[model samples]
Target: MSTGLGRGAGRRFGSGWISGVLAVTCGALGYGGVLCLLFPSWLTTPSARALYPLELVRFLIYVMLVLGFGLGALSVVLRRRKVLGFTGIALATAGTLLGGSSAEIGTLGGTTAVGLDWFLLNLFILALLFVPLERVIPRLPEQAIFRPGWTTDLMHFAMSHLLVQVTVVLTMLPAGVLFRWATQPWLQDAVAAQPLALQFLEIVLVADFTQYWVHRAFHRVPWLWRLHAIHHSSETMDWLAGSRLHLLDIVVTRGLSFVPLYVLGFAPPAVYAYLVFVSFLAVFIHANVRFDLGPLDWLLATPRFHHWHHAANPVDKNFAVHLPWIDRLFGTAYLPAGRWPEVYGISGSPVPQGYWRQLAWPFLR
Candidate 1:
């Protein structure tokens, strides 16, 4: 009887492993194929004279990212121990691909060199920042962490920033036309007279404020919470977990977050700088790294603070993104002295496991 029970357990484990591997394989292939079909231009290498011609390299890098994510997901599904290692490898490969000369995409001067430098710098910075934390965080319980799939969460995060950047650039076209068609010379002159730094600050502040409100709204509205919950549902809190937001949520929140910055006349350079800085902070705040900022916690957000937001109990606090001041001012701040929630994620609801289902669930419901 004991032998039979052992055999039954072994068969169940084997079956689970097989199912996970198949899911990862199918997800990667399906995602890659769909991306290739939908954005054929993204796969094309531009002419030699093109300022940013890194299209082909970018495509290949994305492929590697997909594969790496697949491997990471597979590791989780199989209950293997190399999930972070595989994810790191994938991130490194993506960095290398973006660092190559062929991955340039914009009219920025010295496109190839600039792209290479930015890619390498960002890769190094993110790796240095998160790799250590990945090492430190305890392995999450199986039920709490989402099993890895196609790394769609990362893709979602990337696409949100990328689309926002692209849209900001496109807005300049209309700004130029308005400049050309303006009936009020004083208005144009007023904008021109504004100091570069002040103008930049105005843009960033506007964007930040907009994002804070949008985030708050997501929590306040039940329908939207369905989409947003996917982000909060991750039982395991880590760098990658920050990328788990649904695409619809990304579009709405990011679009609202960016429009104010664009309309306020924020220079592209300033916007880029702010984004890089905030991106770094976002990763740090969501990371499993242990650090205490003491009084500074009241001023800025951190992992410990944000983790509380992800807690299952008393789900009405910690909605501000970068600044806790907003939460405090609005009476949503719930941090108590020397106390932290013991567990994170939604208490009840049948959440989907894979990226595709999560993406489609909002629409289906």
Candidate 2:
């Protein structure tokens, strides 16, 4: 099952692709800078301050601008990628002119946190780390780095990252309103009194148990299936493929998961730790690399575990996203000895191509 477009065949690194990638990178940085400059209070992440001071982030942005220009110059010198070079320079120049990387936050107070800062930082870091990993140790060696529908998936990634505030607001909206009445201080305190490791373990168990049923519903229920099917429509599974989720799907599933955590009243640190772990694990399970964790595959969901969920032949199996045991308990588990799906995607996908159309699809009926 080798697609000639695999990593071996993708090394040509077409000039057009190079230019397009560079252009997007430069544009995102410039766009992020403008957002920070104009709405600094609303476009920064709260976690960023704990990770690094504002001054350091600003300094790094400046360094990225310098590198952007240098790359642009190298592109032009090579003559093969002049368009990428020039466009990158132009965007980088615009960003510099607008004080995009400037540390000064005049009168904005820089308080209301957004996802732009997190988005850019994560974008750079994830690409730097994962792209090479996928290429070098690909599960499907024949799978290309730039597989079909990559652009659509990329848009999904950008939207989810850039609209972090909106996601948080919508997901937590139910928690804010319902938890106010449902929360039992005693229950919360009891749960929080457990050891840190126990708290973390319990959080995973509770969250994934709820998510397991919610995830299954997305496949069993017709309307919800319409939204979730979009997630499973990717013909090529990779890190970016996990990002191709419908916004409504994200809100509903994530919102559902939040209910238990809030009602149970897990400590703030435990809750935050769970969120961070889920974020990384989500990408890990959907990654293109081959990592069959021998015995752990039965315990934790791996790429193969998730790939089976997305398999066209047996679409309704393996609904558990993190823990494999949930499926085992519910009788939906379908790992057949030692086998991987020959192909991945929806069986008869009617989903449209672009992001907007797919988003509007669920309500069309």
**Candidate 1 lDDT (Cα, 0 to 1):** 0.57
- Write candidate 2's Cα lDDT for 147-238 as tens digits: 88888998898888878878888999888887789888898899888887788888899889989989988888999999998898888999
Number of the top lDDT candidate? 2
TM-score of each: 0.60, 0.88
Q: Per-residue lDDT for 28 in model 2?
A: 58
> Ten consecutive residues with minimal summed lDDT in candidate 1?
110-119
After superposition, which runs of candidate 1 have C-alpha atoms over 4 Å from their true positions?
A: 1-125, 134-201
Worst 10 residues of 2 by lDDT: 1-10
| Candidate models: Cα lDDT each | 0.57, 0.78
- After TM-score superposition, what is the CA distance of residue 127 in candidate 1 from its true location, in Å? 3.5
